[model samples]
Target: MPLSLYLLAVAVFAMGTSEFMLAGLLPAIAPDLDVTVGAAGTLTSAFAIGLVVGAPLTAVLARALPGRWSLLGSLLLFTAAHAAGAVAPDLPVLLATRVVAALAYAGFLAVALTTAAALVPADRKGRALAVLLSGTTAATVAGVPAGAALGSALGWRAVFWAVAALCLPAALGILTGVPARRTPQDAAERPAVRAEFAQLRNPRLMAVMLLAALVNAATFAGFTYLAPVVTGTAGLEESWVPVVLVLFGAGSFTGVTAAGRLSDRHPGPVLATGGALLLLGWPALALLAHRPAALLALVFVQGALSFAVGSTLVTRVLYEAAAAPTLAGACATAALNLGAATGPLAAATTLDTPAGDLGPFWLSTLLALSALLLAAPLHPALRGTGRTDAPG
Candidate 1:
């Protein structure tokens, strides 16, 4: 992997930290901002919605600009948004800042994906993408908890300020580390904007995007509601939440690492086996949520299966849309974020029902099956390296 890829991952780590840490900080933010916890929860939605809208829009807009420049600009925007958010005096202001920060996050990730894929040989695309996505796994492992702890210690605003402070070095590192010069991937440089849009018309690519989205929805639904299952269902102390989450994160890291090595050679088998295991995991989670030992073990196993499948799909999306390299990254980000936003929102509907915490598990099962069903026809498409020169 290139140093630039690691630098991009660092930036991604910063963004990913801000992305979901708000889930833990909501309790602190609600009273300070004078909103109900339910209303304060909209901040997470704002970020998710921003990501869905911003990724493709920003990538399309930045098509003519250098990738490094785009990365720097997004980081600056992200940092500024966080700084403003840290001082926001009202809920609406904080929500707006979240949206703006998410837009920046989407933009940075959109560019980062394509840039990372472009950094290596066609055969190594999956591994390259994994290197980039490892940042998110790392965020789940370390950054999210650290942000939550900081918020608990100082206040929610402290977490915002800390994220802002963290972005500065990442932005600087990216600006200096990412080279401006082009490579083989840039040879077809400057595909017309309309031509890029046309790539979206490809059925296989679009199908892959949808499959990726649905798979993400399943895992995130489970992830979003995990604390409840760990506490209310399994009867664990609230303090154990972070420990369990770390296990999930560690599992995710392992999943992505394994996928990096296997994805290029075995995309079909990886997706099929991972998806099946995840399909089986949700119901088992529902059954075992009461068994602390079983629940902990299941969380780790499910986490591994979830990302092993999710990362491979993301890698597939990038290659399948190689004809529109810039837009591919954005679409991948948009699709994946769309699921991130949707899963939690969907799972939330199941919460107040008799099913309670286990509702997300059932919902995840359905989502996982839907993703598998969608991928059923795309096996031929997923088999190749997806060279840019191939048919669009």
Candidate 2:
């Protein structure tokens, strides 16, 4: 892997910290923001909405710019958004900042994934993408827990400030390390809105995007409420939540690394296996929520499975949309964020019901099962040509 790949990972770590740290801080944020926990949770959805809207929009806007310049612009905007979030005066202000930050985050990720794949051989594309995604796993392990701890001790505002500080180095890394290069095709193929829109008509590509969305919905539905689930249902103290998150992150890191190596060879089987794991794991977690040891184990397992599916989802989209790799990457990001936005909104509705905390797990199980069913058709489409080059 090139140093640029790792630099992209650094940018992702900063963005991922901002994206996920809010989950752990929801409890603290609710009281300070004068809203219910469910309402505070909308912040996650708001960020997702930004991603849904921003990914393709940024793709269009930055298509004419150099990759390095595009990344730097997004990171600069992202860092400023975090700073604004740190000093937000009310819920609306804070939510606005989240939307802004997510826009930049989504754009950076789309560009980074495309750039990472471009830097490596076709055979190693999956691993290259995985290296970029490892930044998110690392953020979940280190950044999220630290944000949680900071929120517990200082306040949630401090966490935003910390995220802003982290982005400086990430921006500098991109500025110094990432090269400015475009493939011959990249230069010749100018941005065309109608052409990009037409790509959506491809059934296989659409199915891959839907699969990505479903997988994220399943994962985020349960995960958005993990702090409360662990403390209220799993019988753990608030302090232990970060520890469990670390464990989950560790599993995610392992899963992504493993999936990266396998997805290039067996994308279909890997996708099927991940979906099956989620279908099994979420239900088990729901049934065993009262048991702390079992709950802990299940969380780790679910995290691993969720991320394995994620890695494969990206790989499949890239493989199927090889001709429009950047736009396809943007579409994948948008699809996942759409699911991310919907998952917590659905979970919030469920929280208001009699089922309460356990509702999310069941919701996640259903989503995973839906994803599994979708995978059935995808295997045939991917059959012998899973490794074929996209038309340039």
Best by lDDT: 2
The candidate scoring highest on TM-score is 2
How well does candidate 1 match the true structure in TM-score terms? 0.92
Cα lDDT tens digits, model 2, 136-254, are 99998899988999989999999999999999999899988887767788777754667767866788888878888888988888888888888898878889888878878888888
**Could you tell me how far off, in angstroms, the CA of residue 111 lies in candidate 1 after the best superposition?**
0.8
Question: For model 2, which pairs clash?
Answer: none
Task: Looking at model 1, report the run of 10 residues with the lowest lDDT sum.
Answer: 383-392
Query: How does model 2 fare in lDDT?
Result: 0.85
Give a tens-digit lDDT track for model 1, residues 21-79.
76567657889988865466567767888999999999987776788888999999999
TM for candidate 2 is 0.96
**TM-score to native of every candidate shown:** 0.92, 0.96
Q: Following a full C-alpha superposition, what root-mean-square deviation does model 1 have from the true structure?
A: 2.6
